[model samples]
Target: MAQQLAQGGLTGAAKLKAVTDLINSLTQDLSTSSLGPRERDAALDELKVYARDPRNADPIFVKEGIETLSKHAFDGSSATTSRNALRCLANCLLVKPSTRNIFVDLGYPEKASIKLTTAGVEDEFLISRIIFLTTYGTSVNLQNLIDQHHLADAILQNLTRHVKLWTGSSGSSFKAASQDPMTDMALTETAKLLFNVTHFCRQKVDSFTPAIALIVTLICQHALPQPKPLDPPLGSLVNALLTLNLASEQGAAALFPKANPAALCERLIQVLDKAVRSYPDRELDTAVLPLITALRKIYELAPAEGVQRVMQAKLLPTTKDRKKVLGKGQSLASLILRHTTNAMAPEFSKAVSHMLFELSDKDATKFVQNVGYGFASGFLFQNNVPVPESVQESFQASEGGRQRAVNAITGQFIDKETAPELPEMTDEEKEREAERLFVLFERLKSTGVMNVENPVARAAREGHLGRDVIDGKDRVEELD
Candidate 1:
């Protein structure tokens, strides 16, 4: 029919009018109760083809088509027809940005959320497409989906279903049967949707604790020593970890609240230990960042016992085989420190730094000795890096008081406080010092002893002679 419409002698507006008329006829057929299921399905299939064509993605036709398809998408009589309608609408929404708004304007997320309740495999797949479209379409679209459609509950329900299917009947038979690619795809998309949705609706996310726990359990199960062909793939596990990280960032508690903190920390640390052991070889580097972030957030929110448990898990190995498990000379702390110092991406570096800082606060003396005061001071001096308050308190309370305080201020060893009092300077003395420093700076510039473009050198030269004697006082304070 599309080919016929193109081949016809219609030109300009005539061509568009003909296509619009055809779409109108098809939508009318789809919405008519007189039409049988086969006829309606065929019309939906034809509409999907038209929607797929970029040329036919006109707002008028797409708006009409979305309305028609949304009606059938919610129709309870035939899942096949509803699935076909959903596929068509999804295609139309995928056509253009305007068409996506059209979907939202028609409240398709609400309609799709309802269909997700008892959707079959094919229907669920199509519905997930729409959900992804709305969830990730735009921030406005996503916010609307969350606020108006309650997408969090729908996605959590879907995630919970897949997690149950994968975790149930856990023998070889279950593994074999559960390894279906489609199932994994559905689970992955559902997790992604959950992740995006939770970015906006954190309180609602907290309500889905059971579902979140299931994802964490799946991660632990797959990440722990097991067999080949990780049923859901490592990417899905990473996505799950990222989702939990988002939730934890938004005030959700630890992954397992009621579980024993020591044991939970042991399990979490084991996952990291395994990944670090296989690093640069197993390509687990991608997963390690979020896993570390999730672990850090959990530790932050967990009680004192939980923080202690994490510290214990991250402690240096003593036994021969224990050290071998993390690879020779590789404790979890040292591995994270390596990444903190050397990772190519700055965000990874900051995350590792923050995690280490949190752990350090729990046992400051050990981290200060192991990771070194230099590492902590470097973190403090880095541009825009946030030194956690606990870490600040820890540093202040550590033994090397004055030197550490100076290090915190200037990232160097000194026997002065961070902000020491400066002696009152007489104007005559200040003038003399300013004249002397200015002469020294001029001699250095003449002899090329200092880079002329160096701002620090310029500041040093100007510090004494500047109009504001307060500036000179400030510089003296810095020196102290």
Candidate 2:
């Protein structure tokens, strides 16, 4: 009877209530007897049915079901029993949009919805779920659940301990006797969860610090016995730090007061130097660009201050690290010379030369012509670092890069003079000027030139830049 109803063919509230009542009666009747395996299975089946029915679930009943399932959790017959109860409880908490709204109204933000929905974040439900997945096959994958919950650290703690046991002291014991399938399964699931959590945390800077700290802790714990699987987590941590945003300089100032205007840049410089000196090539390659992009954002916000700090920190490193960074006997000096020719901040412009100084002469010309051109167009010229070099030289190397720099400058580019003198010109001169400006406009578009205020990028990404950009731009632009 419980099986038929638990199957979901009979899910109406009335049917669920009847099954709950029947289970309640059975528990009372069978409380004292030790049922045989078959009979125990029958009792387990009834509870599983009641636990799975959404209408039969409430905070009260679900908590009772979890207790009942825990009694036989290690028993093979009880595995499905515990898993069903968890699923049913999760379903009830997530019952409907209106139900979730009730929790939200009570002060739970959307970020905590998983907890609010279950009313179980503080309860044993989350920990128990982790346990069941770690111990037995309950159909749900443990790692997937961790990523979904944003509980990477919790998951790592479980995986590292389990893996150490399976591969270390327990390895000889298990090998001599026989491998325990259940134990091995638990270890595998924990590993997957660890990997998943690392991947999810990589995409955001705000999430990086906690993720790295957790991964490092886990790796250190399992370092001696297991070394092969450490790469992904370690690489991810490096990438996360390298990607911290400089644009948040103002916010960072609030956190680290001893830091000067360039405090954030200096900290990152220290981090990069440490990484290059101690970390592997794979780590550097994957992390450097993202870190630079983050710094560029900070520089965009406060160019002079940001540039001074980045240069003073001497982040580009000595020519040896630069050679390693630029790759293969490449010329670093000439590249630096060519790239910084038109840079806006003389300090950043000069600092980049250090990167070039590290490259070999054979590759220096191409590097300067290409990569150098690119850095200037995108960071210096396009980002409004300023154009100190001859206009023709800057534009020739990266026509697109130059146009982008021009666009950044022109975004705040008010013609300083009140207005152009209203002197008449020949129709031919006017036509020539329009054509020249038209080419520049096309160049900006083709090269993906953007300004300090990236309306195009914002519009493409968020539909609009949000209230801050729209409202702030209106207010800021009015002063000019």
Top lDDT prediction, candidate number: 1
lDDT of 2 by residue, 121-224 (tens): 22223333333233222233334334465454444344444434534644544353124444433333334434443344344334323333333233233222
User: Candidate 1: where is the Cα deviation over 4 Å?
Assistant: 1-22, 33-56, 59-61, 136-153, 169-173, 222-254, 257-288, 303-307, 310-312, 315-334, 362-365, 373-377, 383-480
Residue 366 alpha-carbon offset, candidate 1, angstroms: 3.4
- TM-score for every candidate vs. truth? 0.61, 0.31
For 257-349, candidate 1 gives per-residue lDDT tens digits of 555445445666776666655545234345556666666766666666655655544643222212121122455655665566655656667
Worst 10 residues of 2 by lDDT: 406-415
Q: What TM-score does model 1 achieve against the real structure?
A: 0.61
lDDT of each: 0.56, 0.38
The lowest-lDDT stretch of 10 consecutive residues in candidate 1 is: 318-327
Candidate 1, residue 251: Cα displacement in angstroms equals 9.8
